[model samples]
Target: MMERKLVFGVAVGVAVGACVVAAVVVGRRVKSRSKWKRVVRVLEEFEVAGDTPVRRLRQVVDAMAVEMHAGLASEGGSKLKMLLTYVDNLPNGSEKGTFYALDLGGTNFRVLRVHLGGQRSLSLEHDVERQPIPEHLMTGTSEDLFDFIASSLKDFVEKADDPDQLVARRKELGFTFSFPVKHASASSGVLIKWTKGFSIEDMVGQDAAESLQQAIDRIGLDMRVSVLINDTLGTLAVGHYQDPDTVAAVIIGTGTNACYLERTDAIIKCQGLLTTSGSMVINMEWGNFWTSHLPRTTYDIDLDVDSPNPNEQGFEKMISGMYLGDIVRRVILRISQESDVLGPASTRLLMPFILRTPSMAAMHEDSSPDLTEVARTLEDILEITDTPLKVRKLVVKICDIVTRRAARLAAAGIVGILKKIGRDGSNGIAGGRSRTDIKLRRTVAIEGSLYTSYTMFREYLHEALVEILGEETAPHVILKATEDGSGIGAALLAASYSS
Candidate 1:
């Protein structure tokens, strides 16, 4: 009888243990499903930032305009003596010479040679080479990195097939120091803080031309750095040289900024520094503008939190090419975590920083008969497979919402600039009775990948501007998408400085 009791107790304990194990397995399955569900939902609803409370949108845009004006008026107003670059001179049709331009922007650098003819034919010839930046060099010493660039320049100069035909004896060249710099004149500037994932400690507070010139000389290249120009300034100069009516130039690539011709008298801080001509170029590092009226969606907030500099460049963080796709990724991740639609056991998205901007761009390029491209882009980027058709459609919709909002916001900012410049009228830049011409009228030069390469971004941006500026005035303001303006513009600036 005692042995029978002992066997029964043992059986009872075994049954309880089995029950606990089963419960745990079921619980884990539920939790895993729940987490993945959130991820899918977030991905599908990547429109978090686009759907920002409408009330906040107005506040963001208004503040943005105010900040835009402030930054433009005072270059290098930042603590680093990074004053606003004053490029008071514009190009006339008579700039004649053989010039070279070196463009050192983010991710890649390019070099070009051109022959400028006066108003006659304006003949131009160019050769360019591209090099990818090693990830390690980004965080390395300034001398190491600049020396690398110098070496590349040396090789380029050496390999020239016919130096006499392409370059002049003096070999003066324009350097498009795309990074922020403190400039005392058109031909000289000091390096300011480096942006775009570059963190070389020694480069800041140094003369950009001196470093580059030394490297050029060390490589046995006889080139004089005649001009040190910012990319935005280069864009404006080149655009204006091509078309005198181009009153403004903007770059919306990996970064965003604007440069416009302004009266030196308009700059209050440079009271004694004004040139005799009373006109100067003002570079509005408009990306730094902070505002509440601009669109501020949930995805934007998340991106800001994850970004190196948060609560800054609120507008740039939203519209620029570099961050646009990243924002979409965050939104998608949020949806996957909260929703149950994506099915269970898909934990690929739960990994941090899985989606990148380029991946988002790939997804955005999706335009299949059945929107299969959208799902394909996601799969290609994240290695996920077998996405449902419903989820794919939802993802496309999310991309549309975010991109449309970005276009609209960009349009509004352009309108604000036109308003500030007194070009919002029929009289145009002519100085007669058009001072109060609060009408949209002027040509703007736009340079950037997303603006130029995106499928419908330019059209959408035009539509958005028309919506805000009204139909009648919209025709007066022409937004021309210009290519390679920065490279040529830097050369134009060099010519101007030399003249």
Candidate 2:
């Protein structure tokens, strides 16, 4: 009996020891889980659900309208530099002829020849050649850069047909200078500043059209720059040519900006400006637009601080494709630092723009049950390994939150434009007017890779527009994708402004 008692005691002690061990293990896991939960809570703060509710969006709309008015009121009255594009007339599909467009927006410049057919029955023919701007030339003298462009144009023109034969006609070219410019006329503008990583010191304050023309002359090319326009105006021009109802244009790729047709009388700064159409395309330069109403997060603030142009392009930093992926990276990096779910802090995550917007889009779009693409992106971009499915899901949620916020904010901006034009409400620009009195359809011409290439981004933007505009009024507002509008629209402008 005594021996049996001893064995039973020994077994009881072993069971107690196992229980203690299990408790310790469970406690550690619970603590780890709690840490992850904290990370999730931090991420949730970045969400737009509470930050950009419908009420807040309405406020954004109001603010946007006010800013538009302020910007149009004077040169420096608001953050929005409502620069005049001097494009008094948009293409109306009556243009008939072969025109050339030279696009110098980014690292590559495209030379295009477009054949326009008049009215509804005319067909369009275009041949485009893209050439990479030499790296040295980007930072070289303005003359050198323009010379290179002129030489390329000459070569392309010679290849197309006999240059001498065209000498009698003197081919027309539309120049799309994507940077900020102070327009002197439809065919000329002075460069205000260069953006998008371009740092040509000599280009500022110079006449961009004149420089290009001088280069063309130096190369003995018989092409004249008939219209000097920006990419947003080009987009609006093309959209108008396709659908006359398109009143505004927005670009949402590396950067974001919008342009809209405004009554000449509304441009308070430039008095006595006369145009045949009685309206001119106003480059909103909305990238700089800001109000206290913007739902900015810590991540956004940090991004702005570190950006090359701090305190500038606040809206662009939040919504543009160039910065969205970095925003996701920053969120994930924060989580990794605060928890063990992502394993360890990665140097790759520390690198700026290491995770591009496309990768984020891919991960966000991963529909697999296991989220294989998310896991793969994590491993490839951040070198994060063995991320549990839950953690991978968390990463996806981060992407969704960032992208959704961007898309929704963009929608609000569009709504703001509509409001300013008196298209959002029933008043229709005239007080006491009924909805039925003026229910004309409105279309916003949008270009850039974010709206065209990113499927999820586009869907979210569309969904947000419907939510903001309501189902009844949403159908009246259309967001049309005008791909390569910058290039094609320039050609159309050349035709419209032809002498």
Counting clashing residue pairs in each candidate, in order, gives 41, 0
Model 2 spans > 4 angstroms off: 48-50, 121-123, 161-167, 428-434
Q: Candidate 1 lDDT, tens digit per residue, 200-262?
A: 888889888888888787777777888888877787876777777788888877678777777
Writing each residue's lDDT as its tens digit, candidate 2 over 109-129 gives: 999998886873223578899
Clashes of 2: 0
Write down the RMSD of all candidates, one decimal each.
Answer: 7.9, 2.1
Task: Output the TM-score of candidate 1.
Answer: 0.79
Question: Any residue pairs clashing in model 2, and if so which?
Answer: none
Measured by TM-score, the strongest candidate is 2
Candidate 1: C-alpha lDDT: 0.69
